[model samples]
Target: MTVALATSLGDDALILGQRLAEWCGHAPTLEVDLALANIGLDLLGQAQFFLGAAGAAEGQGRDADTLAYRRREDEFRNCLLVEQPNGDFARTIARQFLFSTWQALLFPDLAQSAAPAIAAIAQKAAKEVAYHARFAAEWVVRLGDGTSESHRRMADGLAWCWRFTDELFMDDTAKFRPEWDSHINATLTQAGLATPKPVRGITGGRHGRHTEHLGHILSALQYLQRVYPDATW
Candidate 1:
């Protein structure tokens, strides 16, 4: 169970990192591009730690790179939220806001985990996730209240991203929904945006079932390692 949990969390970070990295040179502005790149690196770092821990737990001697670069798409256990296409800046912000909020809530709990390694990783990751949540929240408010077109785009982004929110609470220990709700609601309210009406969430990613997007992500992410097995700097 510990291995599974670690692998899942690692997959979440790895996939989201890849998504954010896609915006390295393409974000709305130079500052935003750099910020997204840095966030992506943070997530990738978290993924490496979690996957390394998971490899140790599995006792297969696979290590992080082996687990990450060699996995098939169906073997990945990231949530559906992270794999969705980056539709627009607003949509990406909405996705980031929803996910980073949940991560901020989750990492604190994991920081106190009985598993020592997991706890250590969580402690370090919690700080990073907090900043991620703050960054996303700031953008959510900025775009949501900025102007008519931005407002429409932000609202639409929220709605588009809303269906994935419920999956974040599916873990029995993930009981922070109320806190998440309060935080998100306050942000939306302040931004003059409506909280999205709850919808039947698109689930199953945790079980290795994913949207088609994950396949494309994996193809690109694994390409270098796949074509040049074990080639190193």
Candidate 2:
């Protein structure tokens, strides 16, 4: 269960990190672009640590490289929200706010997990995610309450992102992960951010079903590896 949970969380970070990297040069402003890049790097670093630990815990020869570069699309465990394209600045901010908020809540609880290794990763990741959540919350408020144009875009972005919010809270695994849902809601509420009600949507990422974007993302992310199977940097 420790290995499985850690791997799933790592996959979430990996996929979302790739998606955020897509905005490196395309964000609306230089500052926002740099901010997203920093977040992407943070996620990537977390993915490496978590996936590596998961592999070790599972007693598998596989490591982060194998898990990240060689996994098939259907084997990825990222939520659908992360794989969605970075539509607009507001859309990106909305996605960040929602995911970071969820991660912030989830990690702190996981930090106390019965699994020591998992708890360690969660403890370390919780700190980084706290900052990420703050960054996202600030952007959400700035855009949401900004000028008329910014407000409109932020609202539209929130609407688009709201649909995916349901999947985050649905734990079909019955793992009974304690306090995960309530913790997230309370944090977001305190921050004056609202997440959509926990209505189930098409949810299978944790079970290895992924969005169509996963294939495309894998193609690009693994291109160098695929092209030069025997080469290393």
Candidate 3:
């Protein structure tokens, strides 16, 4: 269970890191570009720690490199929300706000995990994610209230990703639902955006079932490893 938990966390970071990295030179402004890239690097660092710990907990010879570069799509455990494409600047912020909010709630509790390594990783990751959530929340409010077109895009982005929010609480930490709800609601309200109506959430990403996007991501991530079976860094 501990190994599985670590792998799940690692996968979340890995996939989201890849998604954010896609924005490296493409963000709206130079500052925005650098911010997204820095956040992506932070997630990748967390991924390395968690995936390495996962390999250790499982007593497997596989290390973080092997796990990251060799896993097939169905073998991954990241939530579907992180794997979704960065549809637009607004969509990316919406996804970041939603996922980082959940992370802020989750990693603090995980910092107290029975496993010392997990606790350590969570302690560090929690700090980074707290900032991630704040950064995203600020953009959400700015875009959601700034102009007619910006507000429309922000609302559309939230509605696009709202269905995936339920899966974030599907684990044993479901108790955080109330806090997540309050934070998200307050953020949206302050942004002059209406809260989206509840939708039936799509689940099962935890069980290695994911949307089509994961396969494409894995193909790019694993291409070099797959083609050069004996290559060394």
lDDT of each residue in 5-112, candidate 3, tens digit only? 899999999999999999998999999999999999999999999999999988979899889998888889899999999999999999999999999998999898
Candidate 1 regions off by >4 Å? Answer: none
Top-down lDDT ranking: 3, 1, 2
Show the lowest summed lDDT stretch of 10 residues, model 2.
172-181
Compared with the true structure, model 2 gives a TM-score of 0.88
1-233, model 1: which lDDT tens digit per residue? 77988898899999999999999999989999999999999999999999999999999889999999999998998999999999999999999999999989889988886388788999999998999999999999999889999999999999998998887888664589999999999999999999998788889999999999999999999999999999899
Where is model 3 more than 4 Å wrong at Cα?
Answer: none
Best candidate, lDDT: 3
Clashing pairs in 1: none
What TM-score, computed on C-alpha atoms, does each candidate reach?
0.98, 0.88, 0.98
| TM-score attained by model 1 | 0.98
Of candidates 3 and 2, the better by TM-score: 3
Give each model's whole-structure lDDT.
Answer: 0.93, 0.79, 0.93
